[model samples]
Target: MKATTRKIRDADATKARILAAAKSEFARVGLGGARVDEIAERAQANKRMIYHYFGGKEDLFKVVLEEAYLDIRNAEQALALDHLSPREALETLVRFTWQYYLDNPEFITLVNSANLHRGRHLEGSERLRVASRRFVEMVRDILERGAGEGTFRTGVDPVQLNITIAAIGYYYLTNRFTGAVMFERDYMSEDALEQRLAFNIDTVMRLVLA
Candidate 1:
C-alpha cells in the first residue's frame, strides 16, 4: 500500500511539473508558437512522458488554458465578497481584479491564445461555465444589495459590469508598451499604477453607484 501511494504521488508530481512548464511556454509564445519538446525540457521530463500523461500538444494546451481560467475564478471565490458591505464589496472586487491581472499577466496571454482559436477548447469546459455562473451570481448579489440600500442604481447587468472590470485592467496592461510609446510615459511606474488602480475603482463605482 505504501509503494502504491508513493507511485501515485510521483505521478501527480510529474503531471504538475508538465503543467507548469506548459503554462510558461504557452504564455510566453502562445499556443501556435509553443513546442512540446521545449515544454518537456523545461519540465525535466521525457517527451514521451508528456504525451503519455497529456495526450499531445493541443490537448496539453487546452488543459493549461482551463487551469488558468480556473485559477482566477477560484481566487475570486476566495475573496468572500458577500461578507462585505455593497460599496466595499464592489470596490474590493475592482481592486482585486486589477491586482490579479497585474500579478498574473500570463493569464492574459493564455486567454489571448485561446481567443485566437475562437475559444475552441473552452467550449467544452463545463467546469468553466459553472465557475463563471457562480462569479456572475456573486456580482449580481452585490448589485442587488447596493440597490436595496439605495446606494446603487437597479438593473445593472452583472455580465457587462464584469466585462468592463476585466477590460479596464486587461487592456491597460496588454497595451502598456504601446501606451508608453504613444503617451511618452511609463504606464507601469509606481505612481502610474496607483493612479490607474484608483481610476479603475472610481470608474466601476460610478458605473453602478446611484
Candidate 2:
C-alpha cells in the first residue's frame, strides 16, 4: 500500500513539473514556436513522458492555458465581493486583476500569443470557453449590482467594460517589446508601471462610476 501511494505521489509531481515547464515554454515561444523537447528538458522528464501524460504539444498547450485561466478565476473568486460595497468591489476587482497579471507575467504572454493566432489553438476547447464566459459573467454581475445601487453608470455593457479593463492590464504587460521601441523608455520600470496601474484604475472608475 505504501509503495502504491508513493507511486501516485510521484506521478502527480511529475505531471505538475511538466505543466509548469510547458507553461513557460508556451509563454516564451507561443503555441507554434514552443518545442516539446525543450519542455521535456526544462521539466527534467523524458519527451515520451509528456506524450504519456498530456498526449502531445497541442494538448499540453491547452492544459497550460487552462491552468493560467484557472489561476485568475480562483483569485477573483477570493475577493469576497458580497462583503464589500459596490465601489469597493470594483476597486478590489481592478486591484486583484492588476496584481494577478503582475505576479503571473507568463499568463499575459500565453494569452497574447494565443490571441495573435486568432485563438485557433484554443477554439476547440469548450471547457476553456465556458470558464472564460463564467469569469465575464462574474464581472458583469458586479457591474450590474453597482449600477443598480447608483454607484456605476447605467447601460454599461459588462462585456465591453471587462474587455476594456483587460486591455488596460494586458497592454502594459504584453506590449513591452513594442512599447520600449515606440515609447523610447523602459515600460517595465517600477514607478512607471505603478503609475500606469493607478491610471487604469482611475480611468475605469471614472468611466463606470462617474
Candidate 3:
C-alpha cells in the first residue's frame, strides 16, 4: 500500500513538472514554434512520458491555455470582491487585474498566442469558460450594487466595463516600449509605474463613479 501511494505521488509530481515546463515552452515560442523534445528535456522527462500524460503537442497546448485562463480566473475569484462595498470592490478589481498582468506577463503572451491561432485551442476549453463566468457574475453584481447605492451611473454594461478596466492596464504594460518612445518617458520606471497605477485607478473610477 505504501509503495502504491508513493508511486502515485511521484506520478503526480512528474506530471506537474511536465506541465510547468510546457507552460514556459509554449509561452516563449507559442504553439507553432514550440517543440516537444525541448519540453521533455526541460521537464527532465522522456517524450514517452509526456505523450502518456498529454497525448501530443497540440493537446498539451490546449491544456496549457486552459490552465492559464483558470489561474487568472481563480485569482479573481480569490479577491471575493462581494464582501467589500461596490466602490471598494471596483478599486480592488482594477488593482488586482493590473498587478496580475504586471507580475505574469507570460499570461499575456500565452493569450496572444491563442488569439493568433484564432482561439482554436481555447475553444476546446469548457473548463476555462465555466471558470470565467464567476468573474463575469461578480462584475455584474458589483455594478448592480454600485447602481443601487447611487455611487455609479446606471445601465453600465458589465462586460464592457470589465474590458475597459483590463484594457487600460494591459495596453499600457504590453505597449510600454512604443508608448515610452512615443511619449519620451520611462514607463517601466518605479515612479512612472506608480504614476500609471494612479492614472488607471483614477480614470476607471471616474468613468464609473456617479
Candidate 4:
C-alpha cells in the first residue's frame, strides 16, 4: 500500500509538471508552433512519459485548453456572485473578467490558438461545454433577478451579455501592443487600465440597468 501510494503521488507530480510546461510552451508559440520535445525538456520529464500520459500533442493541447477554461470558470464560481445584488453581481463579473485576463495573459494566447484552428481542439469537450453552460446560466439568473427587482431591462440575452463582458477586456488586453501604437497611447498603463475597467463596468451597467 505504501509503495502504491508513493507511485501514485510521483505520477501525479510528473503529470502536473508536464501540464505546466505544456501550457507555457503552447501559450508562447500556439499549437502549430509548439513542440513536444521542448515541452518534455521544460517539464524535465522523459519524452516517452508525455506520450504515455497524454497520448499525443493534439490530445495534450486539448487537455491544456480544457484546464484553462476550467480554471476561469472555477474562479468565477468561487466569486459567489449569486449572493450579491443583480447590479453588483454584473459589475463584479466585469471587474473579475478584466482582472482575470490581466493576471492570466497566457489564457488569451491559448484561446487565440484554439480559434486559429477554428476550435477543432475544443470539439467533443463536454467538460468545457458544461462549464460554459453554467456560466451562461449564472448571467441569466442575474438578469432575471434584476428584471424582477425592476432594476434592469427585460429580454436581454445572457449569451450576448457574456460575450460582451469578455470582449471588452479580452480585446483591449490582447491588442494592447498594436492598440497602443494605433491609438498612440499606453493601454496597459496603470491609469489606462483603471479607466478601462471603469468604462467596462459602466458599459455593462448601462446595458442591463432599467
Candidate 5:
C-alpha cells in the first residue's frame, strides 16, 4: 500500500510539472510555435511521459486551456452570490474577473494566441464552451432575479451585459502595454489598475441598475 501511494504521489507531481511547463511554453511561443521537446525539457519529463499522460501536443494544449477555464469558473462558483444584492453581485463578478486577469496573465497570452489563429486550434472544445456557458448562465440568472426583485433595471439582456462586463476587464489586460504607451503611463500601475477596476464596476452598475 505504501508503494502504491508513493507511485501515485510521484505521478501527480509529474503531471503538475508537465502542466506548468506546457503553460509556459504555450504562453511564450503560442500553439503553433511551441515545441514538444522544449515542453519535455522544461517539465523534466521524457517525451513518452507527456504522450502517456496527455496524448499529443494538441490534446495537451486543449487540457491546459480547459484547466484555465475551469479555474475561473470554480472561482466564480465560490463567490456566494446568494448573499449579495444584484448590484453587488455584478460588482463582485467584475472585480473577480479583473483580478483573475491580473493573476493569470498566462491565460491571457494563451487566449490571445488562440484568437490570432481564429480559434482553429480550439476545435472540439465543446466541454470548455459548456463551462463558459454555465458561467454566463449564472450571470443571466442573477440579472433576472435582481430585476424581478426590483434591484436591477429591466430590459437588459443578461448575455449582452455579461459580455460588456468581460470586455471591460479583458480589454484592459489585453491592451495593457499598448494602453501604457497610449496613455503615457503604466496602465498596470497599482493605483491606476485598481482605479480602472473600480470604474469598471461603477460603469456596469450604472448601465445595469441605474
Candidate 6:
C-alpha cells in the first residue's frame, strides 16, 4: 500500500507539472499555436506522457481553462470574508481581485484565449462551474449580510456584482497595452496601479452601498 501510494503521489505531481506548463504555453500562444513538445520540455515530461495523462492538446486546454477558473475561485474563497463587515469584506475582495490579475497575467491571457475561441473549449466544464458556484455563494452571503445591516442595496444580483468586480480588474490588465498607447503613459506603473485599485474599490462600494 505504501508503494502504491508513493506511485500515486508521483503521478499526481507529474500531472500537476504538466498542467502548470500547459497553462504557460497556452497563455503565451492560443490553442492554435501552442505546441505539445514545448509543453513537454517545460514540464520535463514527454509528449506521450502528456497524452497518457490528458488525452490530447484540446482536452489539455479544457483542463487548463478549468484550472484557471479553479485557481481564482479558490483564492477568493480562502479569504474567509464572512467574519468582516460588509464594506470591509467587499473592499478586501476588490483589492484582492485587482491584485490577483496584476500578479497573474497568465490568468488573464488564458481567459482571453478561451474567449477568443468563444469558450467552446470550456463549454461543459463542471469542475469550473462547481468552483464558481462556491464563489457565488460567498458573494451571496456577503450581500445578505450587507442587506441586513442596511449597508447594501437589496436584490442586488450576486453573479452580476461578481462579474462587475472581475470586469473592473480584468479589462484593465487585458487592455493595458492599448490603454498605454492611447493615454501615452504606462498604465501598469506602481502609481497607476494604486490609483486603479482605489478607483475599483470606490466604484464597487458605490454600486453596492445602500
lDDT of 2: 0.85
**Count of steric clashes across candidates, in order:** 0, 0, 0, 0, 0, 0
Would you list the rank order by lDDT, best first?
Answer: 1, 4, 6, 3, 5, 2
Q: Write the per-residue lDDT of candidate 4 for residues 114-203, one digit (tens) a residue.
A: 999999898889998999899889999999999999999999999999999999999998888899998999998999999999999999
Task: Write the residue-wise lDDT of candidate 3 on 28-135 in tens digits.
Answer: 999989999999999999999999989999999998899998999999999989999999999999899888998998899898898899999888677887887878
Span of ten consecutive residues with least summed lDDT in model 5: 119-128
- Between prediction 3 and prediction 6, the one with superior TM-score is 3
Q: What lDDT does model 4 reach?
A: 0.94
Tell me the tens digit of each residue's lDDT in model 1 across 1-210: 999999999999999999999999999999889899899999999999999999989999989999999999999999999999999999999999999998988999998999999999889999999999999999999999999999999999999999999999999999999999999999999999999999999999999989
Name the runs in model 3 displaced over 4 angstroms.
none
Comparing 2 and 6 by TM-score, which wins? Answer: 6
Q: How many residue pairs clash in model 4?
A: 0
Worst 10 residues of 1 by lDDT: 102-111
Q: Least lDDT summed over 10 consecutive residues: which range in candidate 3?
A: 124-133
Can you write out model 5's per-residue Cα lDDT over 1-210, one digit (the tens) per residue? 999999999999999999999999999998889999999999999999999999999889888877877788888989988678877788888888888888889988888877887877567778778877888778888888889888888888877887788799888888888888888988878999879988998889888773
TM-score per model over all chains: 0.99, 0.90, 0.97, 0.98, 0.91, 0.95
Error of 3 at 31 (Å): 0.9
Writing each residue's lDDT as its tens digit, candidate 2 over 17-41 gives: 9999999999998888999999999
Which of 3 and 6 is the better model by lDDT? 6
Error of 1 at 85 (Å): 0.2
